[model samples]
Target: MSKHNDQIAELLTDDSFVRWINGDANTLEQRKWNRWLEEDPANIAVVRQAKKLNELLWFEEEQPNTQKELKRLESALIEERTLPSEGINRGGMGMALWTKVAAAIVLLITVVGVIRYAHWGPKEPEATEQPIMATTQTGYGEVKRVTFFDGSKIILNANSKLTYPKTHQGGDMQVELQGEAYFNIAHKSGQEQRLFSVLTAEGKVAVLGTKFNVNTHSEGTEVVLEEGKVKVQKTNPKDRANKPYIMSPGELAMLFSNKSNIKIQNVDSELYTSWKNFELKFKNTPLHRIADRIEEIYGVEVEFSNKSLREIEFSGSAPNKNFEVLLEGLRTLLKIPVTYEGNTIIFGS
Candidate 1:
């Protein structure tokens, strides 16, 4: 018991051992502990016990019964130590060692418990008000139409998710979007005109009765207005002081997350909004953009072995309802090598 007490005291006094147990060890301290374990494998049980004790003391909501837990831990350590080592029975030595370690284990538990109680203790969780949210998700190659109580309609494209409040109490009709979706926001006139905002990872699109197509991708969020008007704002912290970009009919707004500016352009609305009709219309669209759409819809990674293959443009319409049909058309029209390896679609042999 005195021997065990001496070992525990020595380890507690060692800053490296204490830091390692507390998971605060730097790279050098971690290497030091690893070397100690490799040099003396017998110390593994002590290290594990110290880690478990620390976890039980800190993460546990209710105070643990120190006496009972200590006894169980002591028994586990004794059993682990007594196991046969190197084809020889070390049961007798393990029992004697554990008996010597009992007092040391108790001292460690007492000291750690006192410190924990003095500095940190379980806290009562504060109550938080949470809004009731309703979410709609579409799987790969599947399109879904969601209708809201205010007669607003949203057509979610494949592999997209939309979350909004279950009911509108009338401040701002806000919803969050991930992936691509086409919006036909209901027109509100007079005092009933509430701003309809679509939140995305890149930015927010605020509209008052408009038809638009929004696609969220790795680069950022793209918004193409079919009719009416919409305001686009980038969520970048540096651009927070800047005013939102306004878009009119036949205008496309791109909100880049990494950049502090929003890009607005005039584009053919059909090129972006035709997907809702189970087809995709491309007009001199680059292969990389097509690959982005394919990846976004089918949830498959598209890679081009040749960098120049991504620059090739395609001008045609393809059936988007069937993924294989679209890939077949791409292969036939492009006359390039398209191969499927697991979930990845590789172009150029």
Candidate 2:
């Protein structure tokens, strides 16, 4: 099995993880698993896979007698397969181990088959049976472009991931995002237009074909509209009851992690969306803010030799396609000493 399959198999065999997936874990176990997820956001994807597998394995509460089901499943596997030469034992212990491994591999194969069918299956009414889900990701200092079947496009920023369906047909369309992206949503024709939405851990942004930028961070999420309009809502209960904030072009909507209020203000959309064009526009933007961008894009730590250098402002544009190019431009434009030590970038002599 592949590394991912190995992870899923390991997770499936763990009692705590199984309980967590079934939502039967105690409060302490729940808290522990929650913390594990919060520590590394990437774990969420793995957990999602595990949950899907668990669901398909008849691990739900509706299962008619889980013990009997397991016995039937194990007997069927045992009858159909033989153990390896080394693990073969008359005592039945090896059979048990082989059964578990085989079950996980079967589940993996089922998932792959579903994806394959989505790609190559007949294009009749069965097309909607398996909605093809696609994922686009960019590593540190890397960017990616994703275009939907409808010609709508998204320029995903560095250290970002977007999970969306391959097609935008069938009612409202939605995509889940982690990190930042610039969206150029295409308007659907006809009198009834389908609503498009972007979902983040912070909240959701609903629109009807618009140009916008969404940035999700540890603190919260920010939506900057460049063209058309968008509606921003907060998922937190304290703010959920309130109506979503309707936004216009050149407007910014913010939802803070700790705050229950959704704040709206007018802003220059270019400053936020400029990265989509491989450029960073600074209008009296301070060095600290620049450092923040460098850290975010390059996945590095930034420091200032003198704290006051952080407050120094610059009004210019710099190429962001390459970290080295941006760093060189900053050095010449700021007329300051910029050096790198290990993975950390330092400004000031």
Candidate 3:
């Protein structure tokens, strides 16, 4: 038998879970499902895969656009299957793992067929099945915790919006993100390991399972790895010739939208990821970079009177505090001048 066969089978056949997957769960069933997720964290990844298959099944059955999606998947799979296996001498992503998973399922679509394969998960719901989707948006001063049926949770930062399907596709997961979020991705093992991926305008980050942070804006996309590894692929047409960068724990990947080159550096993960804990930390970080982050988090603007202010590096941690108090702490800690004008903060004389 294949790895994870028993656990996967149980989840796919669970009566209450099946109702929830097909979006037919009653109030009591929904409550029970949530309780099941809480009872054992390890069950999260298994449940997530089941959800993905459910969404794919529903989409193929009800959506008018299924043909278009299937065609794309077929092309991708054919292309992906023909590519020679390149040895990984380095750390980053090769061919996208998501594509491979999609291809594996596509073969099933052709053999067992789409409709028959769709029924592999559970008994079809009598009610019509539609594609599952949900979105969460947070205010500038707010942070929200989004829990996926897979048990993976996302801590969405202020002024951010995240859109995700109700379930993953083919047991591989993908998400579209705008703004910033820290992901505590649930890990899948056995056959499904190494299938979690994030897509941004700048590029894509793929991993089997890991803790990481992703930030995207007009400037570019930044990925910081706290634990585990990730493959960061550059998506620019101009940089198509560039090699994908693989990052290990304690490393950072910066992909600029305007340039084809990617920059990699070592960083203190706490400096980049501690925001979720209401802690701001720095290690010889420049004031201007600090100002930029303050703007992102507080929804305010910051200006330095002199260009030199942008290059001053200091080391410290700022306790999670209100905007004004944080600026005051900076001023006192650095012995520098800081004044506020409405929502904007100006530094240096």
Q: Top TM-score: which candidate number?
A: 2
Runs off by more than 4 Å, candidate 3: 1-131, 168-170, 191-194, 236-242, 305-307
lDDT of 1 by residue, 103-169 (tens): 2332333212111111012323431223366666555555778877778889988656677777556
For candidate 1, the clash count comes to 1
Considering summed lDDT, which 10 consecutive residues are worst modelled in model 2? 111-120
What tens digits encode model 2's per-residue C-alpha lDDT throughout 228-303? 9888887654644566888999998988877777888989899999988888888889999999987776666899
Model 3 per-residue lDDT tens digits across residues 244-330: 888999988998988788899988888989888877888998988888887776666899888888999979887654554577678
lDDT (Cα) of model 1 = 0.73
Worst 10 residues of 3 by lDDT: 111-120
User: Would you list the rank order by lDDT, best first?
Assistant: 2, 1, 3
Q: Per the 3 Å backbone cut-off, how many clashing residue pairs does candidate 3 have?
A: 4
- As a whole number from 0 to 100, the lDDT of residue 68 in candidate 3 is 70
For model 2 the TM-score comes to: 0.62
Q: TM-scores, in order shown?
A: 0.60, 0.62, 0.59
lDDT (Cα, 0-100) at 248 in candidate 1: 89
